[model samples]
Target: MSKRFSKIAAGIMMMAILVAITFTPVKAQDDNQNADLWQVYETTFKSAKYVDLTHAFSPTIAVWPGFGNATFRATTAGADLPGYINEGETYTYADHGFIATAYELPTDQYGTQLDPPGHWNEYGATISDLPATYAIRPLVVVDVHEQVAADPGYHATVADIEAWEAEHGRIPEGSVVMIRSDWHKRWSEVERFNQKPFPGVSLPALQFLHLERNILFHGHEPLDTDTTPTLEGEYWLLHNNYAQAEGVANLDQVPEAGALVAIGFAKPEGGTGGYARYIAICPPDWPNGVSVVEVPGAPLPVQPYPLRRDENGVLRPTPPES
Candidate 1:
């Protein structure tokens, strides 16, 4: 009878403890900041036109001669699968469930790239060290193509930037400024593309952009900042812990203002350079690019022609219905 009484008391105590726990108050969270951002994506981003400001790099694309060409081939299985295949066999869709390509990239600097300060400064930030806040920013394009057409060795000056500001108001703080020289037109001519006498950004123009206006970074169509004897512009930027974009393309398609840039890059550990993709998000009325609502790619469309491996080991699309 005493043992039964003790068990009943213990059970009552446990019930009281549970009741206290159930009544404890938690702080009320009324903020819907995430929902607000979702609304922005649905309204502004979904309707915006996106232009690819990046170049598709290939084995034959213009690269610094010191770094060799990249190679592509079918990925081979390293070990035998119990029921699927043997060791040292190349995986193909017909045999393995899917096909994968193995890329032998020689250097991270071979393509349209984001060059971190560590590319030149030993103690500076690497590619992975870049912050998530760098994902998007206002885009500013300064047209210097006419100057470049007149002189291939043209380097943009502070006056040019001032002229742009006078006409289009001050460049926004933390915006990305691209010096458009129409230099990407020579991309198909490998030797000519990398040759000297290419358009570049002058040191003064770069200084005004970052130091005075406080821009996030500046980009140019050419691979280097300038063909100057010492590349002083690039040297100063990296030493001062700034990043810049190289080998950017399609600037003529994007507007000079009222646009934003979506910055994306590969974050290899301790990488000095990043293979970057820059996309310009234009206003809905822009005629150049497609909107997210137009090409909502949850399930991507099928190709008109099947891909076939070419003699160069790169895959090419076959002729349709032939």
Candidate 2:
């Protein structure tokens, strides 16, 4: 038989072993479990679909300037290339094929990552300090794709936020307002991803979202809160003010509103930021429908929208102080 055929056969044999080893866990039922509770748990998400808003982490994934790359090195494999197995050991027929990989996780902020308050402020909240419930909250996507397509160095201004509110009805409090710049499409190649200056939140726009609207956090398709050109010595936007999710993808697929976003990641101690699994849990009948009126549990009182709306039903900006 040809060497290629032998390698394929070895791969199939190894896969079968891996499948058996990765069986689902069988956890015991809870003490106060009712049949309805079990049924509800089982059926609640039976028809739900999630949108992957995260970039797959890899050595090929785009890296921020002055950062390292994530890598995975196969330690052992079915193919008899170099050191497939022990020098004298031969392939086994049973489900015990030895295979492993050595990995470099890059920095915590590699690929798609979330920046908590502490990333900027010395005494600010870390990933662990953030409330567990904040992981899953409302999503408000404001598309700036067209504007950025026209001008590579665009900065989403306060007018952009106001315009979004005009249609979406005053971005409700505790929402994660994402600036959809469609930047992720170029993430495969570092050169293309960094080709232009890229868009970012203008100071007033950020102040509107964080201070006036009281959102949970802000997010973007780009790698940082500040535009590439403006990401200079002092990271003003990221320092101790707004939490952020950077290098996110697929925002173009998710709707502008009426969706719940779930961000999952391991909370590393003293972490500035880390890779996150960003998911958009949209309504089953979304795009055709609107945002949920109220979140199930007593609408999270994180930061209720304090500003009032205008005669046109838009959120009026906080008046400039004398």
Candidate 3:
């Protein structure tokens, strides 16, 4: 075989092996026993690196202008509960021995989100209708940061996907493909982050990933899919009963291939959008994330200062000392 053909063949074989290792559960010695998955947890997962891809949402994070900012306040007692506290009284840690927060979220489309089809289509599946199989999938990160750097409004194209395949082989079926633009670095700077010319994914790229490769879904760093006059890319995705992720962060820390994405979301019944969390599980030697073995996490670390409500009503460490 030609050298190029031989290289391509090897790449394909490696991807197939990676897919098998990721999805297929190990068999147990005894068929009736439930130790198979336990073994996988003890062996594979324990040694893998984990990267958080979700951005924590708060009142300050940028949102679509149409959707107003969210509010956070201490949860108050209700009259009908028949408790010691009266209605409209705020609960406090000193008096009630516990404190709770109440969030006044204006929309489900806030922050990192999984946009279900129902967000646009009348007969499409809502957040709660998503299947359990959506829990985990192979992760593919197509880096377009250089293009985005040259052109802030750059939208990834089918050629980008083809180029990625040229190096990483075919994107796995049922995988979650994240378009990496490094736009998320601007997340803290709300105005700049939401400006007119942010990085995005083109409609053709989205179609290729879903129609040709059959990826579970495509995610991007920007909230919207493209900077087209009509946002046709996002419109086409949702109206066609396909879901996509937005406001995803930390793509630079993950590999181009050979990683798994753990998908999680708040399942509000019949909800149009999802408050989503995506975590990337990478190979142990990737060099940027914490491994399960590195941080067992059974007993989480405690902050030096106690949590107290801030001026914005969000809980923050008191005194703000480093």
Candidate 4:
């Protein structure tokens, strides 16, 4: 025995260097556990619970069609003044300076003498009096022209959102897929919610939710979400493709997918959609008592309210009394 075969070849070279230092730290801890399972599935679906589309801008809201001509008044007593307020009492700040007005319903007899009534056209062509920084985002009403008037041109596609993501599973990328169509309960008589022709989202469902599901936003429920005499008669699909960059019109109080939406844009610095105040955050684990005629299915015909059960049972949001 040549010294017992050199002590079994030095014990098989120290067990092959301890199996290469134990699989090099088990392949770097299996790639940090697959990047921590996609960071815990994007932090548990973005802390799940927030679904409010948006829609509330009163003065009998509802707009679109050269958009404008809604007013709110209360001015007199020293009327319209923008000076004298260093110490007040100039008729108590002109008797409570309350001047709210909007216009654009002009297009005939020389545009109604260039919009009379205390004279103030501010540029006047109307698209809802243009300047709220160009209405960039906030007006979420999400669908309701009497439930799409029996589906004439019936919008909402991408194979209806891939059949709602193969029956509710995918749709979670920044999520804001509102489309309620409750055309603001007929926006208080504006030729039946702005010159008829409601129902939205067509254009291959707005380029399949803005270029194949990158959806960070999208909105509907009248007030223009692209489907009027648009696309050629004035090209306006939220100002034609920023891919609905921050779109939202009047989502009649959102509820087609749970709820939680909060917009408050008054940015005004390069502006393009200012004056926003849209909130909706309900989630105590929702499902409280449930009533709104027992929300099962086939009753989402747009929503302007109808989902009762309060006495601590929860399921709130009830606004339909018109």
Q: Per-residue lDDT for 155-235 in model 1, tens only?
A: 999999988887667888999999999999889999899899999999999999999999999999999999989999999
Candidate 2 achieves a global lDDT of 0.67
TM-score of each: 0.87, 0.68, 0.90, 0.24
- Candidate 2 at residue 72, lDDT? 64
lDDT of candidate 4 over 156-252, digit per residue (tens): 6566667555544455454556666555455556566645465567677666665666564565545444555644311333333332312243354
Model 1, stretches more than 4 Å misplaced? 1-35, 320-322
Name the best candidate (by TM-score).
Answer: 3
1 or 4: which has the higher TM-score?
A: 1
lDDT of 2 by residue, 1-322 (tens): 3454344335434433444433433332332233333343333323334678988776666676677776665443445455445543433334245434456775787878888778777877787776787767778899899998998678788899988877666887988888998888888768768555877767677777888999887888777666545563125555735678888899998877666688897788878886788888664443432233333335645444334334423333455455
Candidate 3 residues 1-322, lDDT tens each? Answer: 4454354345445545544455554452344253345556665677778999999998889998899889998999767346568888888888778999999999999999999999988999999999999999989999999999999999999999999998777988899999999999999999888888999898999999889999889999988989999989989998888999999999999988878899999999999999999999876666889998899998998977889988778898797657
lDDT of 4 at 319: 78
Pairs of residues clashing in candidate 2: 258-291
Off by over 4 Å in 2: 1-45, 75-98, 228-234, 286-322
Off by over 4 Å in 3: 1-35, 80-83, 320-322
Name the Cα RMSD for model 1: 15.7
Model 4 misses residue 9 by how many Å? 64
lDDT of 3: 0.87
**Model 4 poorest 10 in a row by lDDT:** 109-118
Total backbone collisions for each predicted model? 0, 1, 0, 30
Candidate 4 regions with alpha-carbon error over 4 angstroms: 1-52, 55-67, 71-74, 77-155, 165-177, 180-199, 202-222, 225-257, 260-279, 282-322
lDDT of the structure predicted as candidate 1: 0.86
Q: Rank the candidates by lDDT, best first.
A: 3, 1, 2, 4
- Ranked candidates (TM-score, high to low): 3, 1, 2, 4
Q: What clash pairs does model 3 have?
A: none
